[model samples]
Target chain A: MAQPNPHNTYLPGYKEVGHHEWRTAENSAPYLLPTLQSLAETNPSLTLLDVGAGSGTITTSLAKYIPQGHITAIDLSPDILSRAASHAASVNATNITFQPASVYELAQTFGPAAFDVVHAHQVLCHLDAPVQALAQMLAVVKPGGVVAVREIDMRVWSFHPFSETMRAWVEVQKATHAAAGGSNEAGPSLVAWAMRAGARREDVKASMGTWLYATEEERRVWGTSFRDRIVGGEMRKKALELGIATEAELDRMGEEWQRWMETEDACCGTLHGEILIRKPK
Target chain B: MAQPNPHNTYLPGYKEVGHHEWRTAENSAPYLLPTLQSLAETNPSLTLLDVGAGSGTITTSLAKYIPQGHITAIDLSPDILSRAASHAASVNATNITFQPASVYELAQTFGPAAFDVVHAHQVLCHLDAPVQALAQMLAVVKPGGVVAVREIDMRVWSFHPFSETMRAWVEVQKATHAAAGGSNEAGPSLVAWAMRAGARREDVKASMGTWLYATEEERRVWGTSFRDRIVGGEMRKKALELGIATEAELDRMGEEWQRWMETEDACCGTLHGEILIRKPK
Candidate 1:
């Protein structure tokens, strides 16, 4: 019999929720596109690998940029990969392929020196061994190719007219993630992780970016998504099981989220740490 | 005909950049100590007022569990107020007075209601009104009392694996502080500032805290000091002259400081947004 995986608590819901909220142009382009453009500038017909390619929103977008080139989108969830495949087909993005694979097993499955660029966004923070995953990412990228990673530095998450409910929610989220052996600190630590994973320090180019949800519509989307995640998703169950928050507290936080969404001047956003490293030729 | 104020550039190097290094057990204790104790169930006698009491590393320590007490330390840079009077006479302390006025004249120099608790740390974020200097520290406190403020949201200052000469330093540091005519995003936008200045939000209790450099001598200080002010303070001059980085850009950031310090695993600290507003009894 197969043993149950402890960290699997949050993954099932994450796949069903689909990451479509993050798929919007407003969220993805500011950080992902620039790195892709920079790489495209160097090799117009590059072959790229999109690791943890959630719903293929970013992958298909990258496919459009490299019309003559190709992209292989991979993920651990077959459900997400199926959705990603459907998304690629809907977009008529022919230059991409979708696969099911874990980032840790990438080198073994794809062979070494297989990609011109390897990219992942908001992914590594959820991995138990981000550095090892980076090593795998590095292994599959050809010499002189680029490996780009972007993750949110949760410490920078802030909002105006502070909310205690939001604060408690953030605490619960962090504790749940930590209990699952993941990190919210992954974003700011990207460069350090890359260097530790065998990339030379001098070869890493680090930058910071943000996703601001300030306008009414944007805030509605952001707040509602978070409210659903907290009140309706498995996160609430995971949090309770972990003893990170009681049900009453979670209910209070959900109400707080509703109140926050209704506040006129309310705005919130997150910071992302981005890094682009060139594999030594 | 008036001579230009030399200190206008950055407050004459903030006499207590000593607060920047945060090396002593005494320095870290004040801010962290009281908050923890307050969460405990106790009456905690505290007749306090710490107006711009720079480096009074003791105001907060005294705030902890003072069952029958008073504390009033004020400052407007008298030579006697040097380094917050040697951090309250280097520990052999007695609750006392150190006054000099001007938190917008302070209810005609401490007249109305005069105390139960009226505190300020890193006061008024350089006050261009400062909600009428927090309505003169809420008309000198005591109709249910408790007025506290702490600021500094240095979100635009960044350095990476050590930028050759701190590239973005001059641009961001100046724009953020200058944009507000004060601080980038001083602590929680003082509730008293809101209530006194006619913001619709009701008075609310808010608290924010931060980690400071303690051990690991190499990480001893990761904050801007007057030394940086005196020697490398061209940021003020550059911001005014070039206008390369906009006020909008400065307003959007609050993560740069965290990223820079973490790169070297260097110890750094931030003053947090804290507010405690008590409704009339």
Candidate 2:
């Protein structure tokens, strides 16, 4: 049996969540590409640090932006890190390296003022000490280096025509996230977190972007992925164990999701807040 | 001299802002159309109560959605309402009727349960009593009717590459909005407001969407519009009179905005939250 993560309430199910996240990360290019391109504009050969690089999806995609640059990708899960390494190797992305590490230990391991750009996507929301981790990230970046973070504000996740099942699902998801010490408001709170982490308010720039799953194929993939996660994955198990939802409720939600996916005009929007802060030189 | 609206801080300059808003509303179809379509899905013949129908841009567009139904469009400003009526007449949209009314007086004017849909775009944020107005909207909406509201959370309005002038422009805009008794955080607070207005939590459905100005024409139009608003319009006068920004600062911001807009990859994202609350049958 795996040990329960004191900080993470969704343990024994993170691996499955991590797998789903890999797919989610892959489809996030629309949101991530622009930020990456912005960072690469000034220095194509920049050194990059990727925090919580699950399954190396974003990391590998990021590799294309900096052909001459090197990437250090870190995650806390050794299993996931190994899987990331294998994926990178299969892709012939030799410029990237995967290592098992925690956000808490970043500054200690990398020393101060280490990288040209530090980036994290959907990482801080899951951590117990997001501010401290952000501080660590800021500490390790060289002066004038950029620290970019992207996160979701799940409170804004809503659907129209008013489905009770979808609402219940959202509530359960939020509860599960909270139980795991995650911040559902992380996206909108990025700048405040950065400022709290000691970055100057004037240095932080915040913008909003979205990932819309509107096409048939996109909706199917998105809906089915959540369906599977809820039915057979750790989310189902944890949700039940935590008493956040009943098995019947989850099942009904799964059906509602499927029905929603089948509706011709059905679309989903995921809102993300992007913050880029440059350390004063 | 115009009476200073206790609830609105931008009274003296509202005419100019309202004119600018007309132009803005003309371009808002991409954001408002889908929501209207969704509400009209089951009921093609929708009797729509359009609150704050400035310039009749959205009201006329909405006429196409409910060809068989009628629209009651209202606004407080007689000048803008006249403009809206002229526009509606020019468009030959016979389904919409323009009137001067306040949100607080909706229920009294229309009586209980008069319309199938009560819709407002970017209106509630400008109200002194958003929740009370919401209650009035709810009162006049028939049972099982839908109340759709869209508002912006200006906090998410941002620009990249860190321009001090741009920041100042945003602050001035924010202050001007505050002076007008507008809620900069209204978009994210929709659901809460609905609940406070006595709607059941489950009856309210909230979703977020964005408008992006990234294409050359889009950037040019967006940039130039703001540039004009800042340099020559009443926003310029109010921003200076209120001491939110200096004339020189506004000039520099105008230049910086033009420069930002001209950048090849420059993109602007305007985040909006849409809520649909169904009256209990």
Pick the TM-score winner. 1
Query: lDDT per residue, candidate 2, B36-124, as tens digits?
Result: 67767877777899998887788887787778888999988888889888888888999888888777777778888999989888888
Question: What TM-score fits each model?
Answer: 0.57, 0.54
Which candidate wins on DockQ? 2
Give one digit per residue, the lDDT tens place, for model 1 in B149-245: 6554455222233342343554455463555467555554554354655433445444444333312332324433422432335444445355755
i-RMS of candidate 2: 9.8
lDDT, residue A5, model 1: 27
What is the C-alpha local distance difference test score of candidate 1?
0.63
lDDT for model 2? 0.73
After superposition, the stretches of candidate 1 with alpha carbons farther than 4 Å from their true spots are: A1-12, A15-19, A24-26, A29-35, B1-281
